[model samples]
Target chain A: MVEAEAELKRLMLAGLAGDAAAHRTLLAAVARHLRNYYRARMRGAPEDAEDLVQETLIAIHTRRDSYDASYPVTAWIYAIARYRMIDHFRRHKRRGGDHIPLDDAPELFTAAEDQASDARRDVMRLLDTLPAKQREAIQLVKLDGMSVKDAAARLNLSESDVKVSAHRGLKALMKLMADAGP
Target chain B: MKTDDLIDALARDPAPPPAPPAPRRMAFALGAGLLLGVVLLVTFFGMRPDIGAAQMPVMMKAMFSALAASVAVPVLLQLAKPGRPLGWRIAAVGGFVLLSAGIVGVALIGGDPTERFQLWMAGAFPWCVAIIPLLAAPTALLLTRLLRDLAPTDLRASGAALGAVSGGIGAMVYAMYCPVDSVAWVVTWYSVAIALCAVLGAFAGARLLRW
Candidate 1:
């Protein structure tokens, strides 16, 4: 991990100095890590999490010059990632709908190790049927690792809104899955 | 879609930018930071014209403008950037530019350093530094959304790492540009201010800016 950071910094500096390959390498190396970071925020919504990862990588590339040489490179990346997450919450807020509590979600999906892959996909599809707000809450709290308070705060929403959204998302998921299952 | 496929899709389809001319974005940042800093400096002078008696014209205004740019540039850029979160980099750029400008304007237009020691520092400077940035809350929100959006996948570690780097950079940038003299002052006050700003920018961006 430490070595990776060093490499990232070296590559970052190199990229800033106009090395295209280093820049590309820096972005690719960090891409997966960014995805995981976004994933945790996504709660249960891998799709949304993935979206964040891609966005952050691009941000890093364009804004690389703003980085200060005196600081540790790792922390800077985290700061950007953190800010992006906040943006995610605000956009959903303007749309005005409920979000789900993340905790309620694992319970909903814990049943299938065997069919987990397709089951998860089905769950996501069912989730897609609901209002954008409710779906987002589930994606955040349930799929992502964000604490309810943190997630609620991010969304600029009351905890209840987060909770209700998760509930509704889950209910929608169950209904859709039940209807399709044998 | 598979997670990887999903990510590819997201990466592939960025929102069309408002327009082109990347320089325009940088210019806007410079402008906003300059404007905000100038206003704050002017106000600071007005509120407590009794600070000292003016300082060095060249250095002071330069310093003030620097501060303002440090805060404003990062914000405007963050707002404009497609995926980048607006936090320390944007804040530092805005704050530095604006503050530096204000410092310069004061020295140039206000008067000479008649030793305006701590009067203004004790009065309006605090509020200008503390309260004013809230007007641009949207910048932080944008950053947060960028972070939240990236959190759920392979990018988590890099994100955290990036946050740390940006925080460190914020501190370094403030240190590099601000005219604080003491090492202890640099380590204690300046560094802390940088960290605080960086953290605030990131935290606000993460929560307030979520997409």
Candidate 2:
């Protein structure tokens, strides 16, 4: 574990120096650790765990400059991950209606182990909450991995409209997932 | 999106323009806050008219707050980054406060018993407390905004440090206009004002510093 932390610290320092490849590698390694961290706590809610992993990765990426060199990289990463979890719980508790009582025998629900498909399904589920135009725009441009121009042509909308729709859709999806806590 | 796809997109995105180091950024915030405080001071509370004769007291008062601010800046900078040990920084702050307390204690012991009330109240107590925080607003806001980008883990402590720094700047600026000459009075009332800022910062930090 100490060696792994040293390696992560090395990659993080390199990433801080603008090495995109090292940053990518650091984030991937962090994601694997976050998966286990959240999975153990989230139990049956693998989708929620995956969402948290993604959210934490985004935070680590955006806030990478805040990582100081004098400290262990794992401690910094753990602090950020812990903050996200606290935020997740706070948001869920505030929403009140959909709060999952994870401490109360979360194992009662069959633990879904196939997280890749679970994540795919989760994305689809979140996409379903958007308006039809936005839903289609995101589906074509984001999920299907089509260019904005191609998605615009397919949806019979202008390219800018497709881009705007996809942007708004993603923003809305993020809000939805933030509100939909487990 | 799949987690892998998200990672790919994040990694492919070009790095953001590098931020100035925490110390430099904090210096900028302090400088800007002081400028705003000066503007506010000139507009509302004009400098004391007997400025030439009052120079000694004003210099002493300003030095007191300025030294506090100097100690606080390093601590605040450390707090901006996660996982940085703050033992020495916090100790420095504590030492500054203890030194101030010692000065006040010495003044009380050496001075007349009849003057004790004057030393504590300083006649301008209300103005001191109110104007210091009013002056602090600019620095406090700027420091908090800077801290949001820095991703401080201990939000309340970071906020308190920034607040104390801002309060020091506020008190320093206020010293220029303040006519009071008693060191004990300055220490007592100014410390109260700075403590108020710290409390306010703690509450504000808990709410605003979350990322």
Candidate 3:
């Protein structure tokens, strides 16, 4: 990563200083980098990656003056790339398609807070396949953050019954997640 | 589009972007804005009534505005880069500290506290609020144009920073022409006016600065 950044910086500085060959070299390098970047995330959707790469390249061409020489050139390039990716997601969402973004800001991959929420949603969807009593017991005691006694009171069952249902539900959920994985 | 063809197309001579990088463009935009602000101040408002004789308080207001501008200028330059953390806490906290000092100074002068508060709230407050945004219009437009094609990851924050610097310049120019000399008034009301411009700038920049 460091070497790539250094090479990009050198090419960018040379390009900015009116080196046409170096400028072409910089654009080609960035395009190659962006292709790998979008391809890895897009997976089965390879066409989207190509489109994103082209949009990103166009942005880089026009917005070259926005680059600050004090910082690494890769930072500016990636920032533009990230914005284009976000816009891509927005367009896809608007078209009534949903996708799990594989990575968030490649360089500063901070694991977006929404990832945890998405996992919770997936777990809940899996939980719906469980028997009704078990699902309710587990949701009350686990998902709702309720005590066993409180869950039993709400379900009109004994605490031990609630515990038994929850334990059985968790065992079933383990199987469900494993089965859904493939 | 094929990567090779696109790259070859980009490699053409016109591919090299225009001169003056992001920092220099921002500097030019702000410099031109400040000059225009000064000209507007001289033409519209004129200097304060006691320019030659009233030495201490009038000059002090100018000093405060200058300090405000000094803090905001570097912040503006730093925020031009995409994804940079805006360390604006110091500028905000420092401005408040300066205003507090002025308030205390006003207290030390032994005026009636209630009446003085009313006076500070009343005198030139609306005009200060009105004029700073008016002055900031040209700066905001220039900064937006300069930033139009650039990738500012945090659009609103960049706009706010630009607005803040413009507001500081506006305050400095307004100080020259303002009739009210009280430090309390300038610090409180002028700061409010400047803050209003910052908010306006942030809103405008969010919509205008998108690539």
> Scoring each candidate complex against the real one, what DockQ results?
0.06, 0.28, 0.14
Write model 3 residue lDDT over B127-169, tens digit each, in one string: 8888877776666677778766456766677778778777877
Candidate 2 falls in which docking quality class?
acceptable
Q: lDDT per residue, candidate 2, A1-182, as tens digits?
A: 35689899999988888899998999889988999999998888788788789778877887787888778988888888877787667544423234557684453343333335455655665565466789999899888899998999999999999999999889877865655443
In the order shown, the chain A TM-scores of the predictions are 0.51, 0.54, 0.51
Model 2 spans > 4 angstroms off: A41-46, A97-182
lDDT of each: 0.49, 0.82, 0.72
Candidate 3 segments exceeding 4 Å error: A17-22, A39-48, A86-182, B14-18, B21-28, B38-56, B83-126, B149-151
TM-score of each: 0.33, 0.77, 0.63
- Per-residue CA lDDT of model 2 for B89-170, tens digit only, reads 8899889989999999998888889988777776554578889999989998899889987888787888888888999999
lDDT of 1 by residue, A94-169 (tens): 3322354776555444334434654464465445445667778888898997787888998889999999988877
Q: Which candidate leads the pack in TM-score?
A: 2
Question: What is candidate 3's CA lDDT for residue A133?
Answer: 83
| Residue A172 lDDT (model 3) | 74
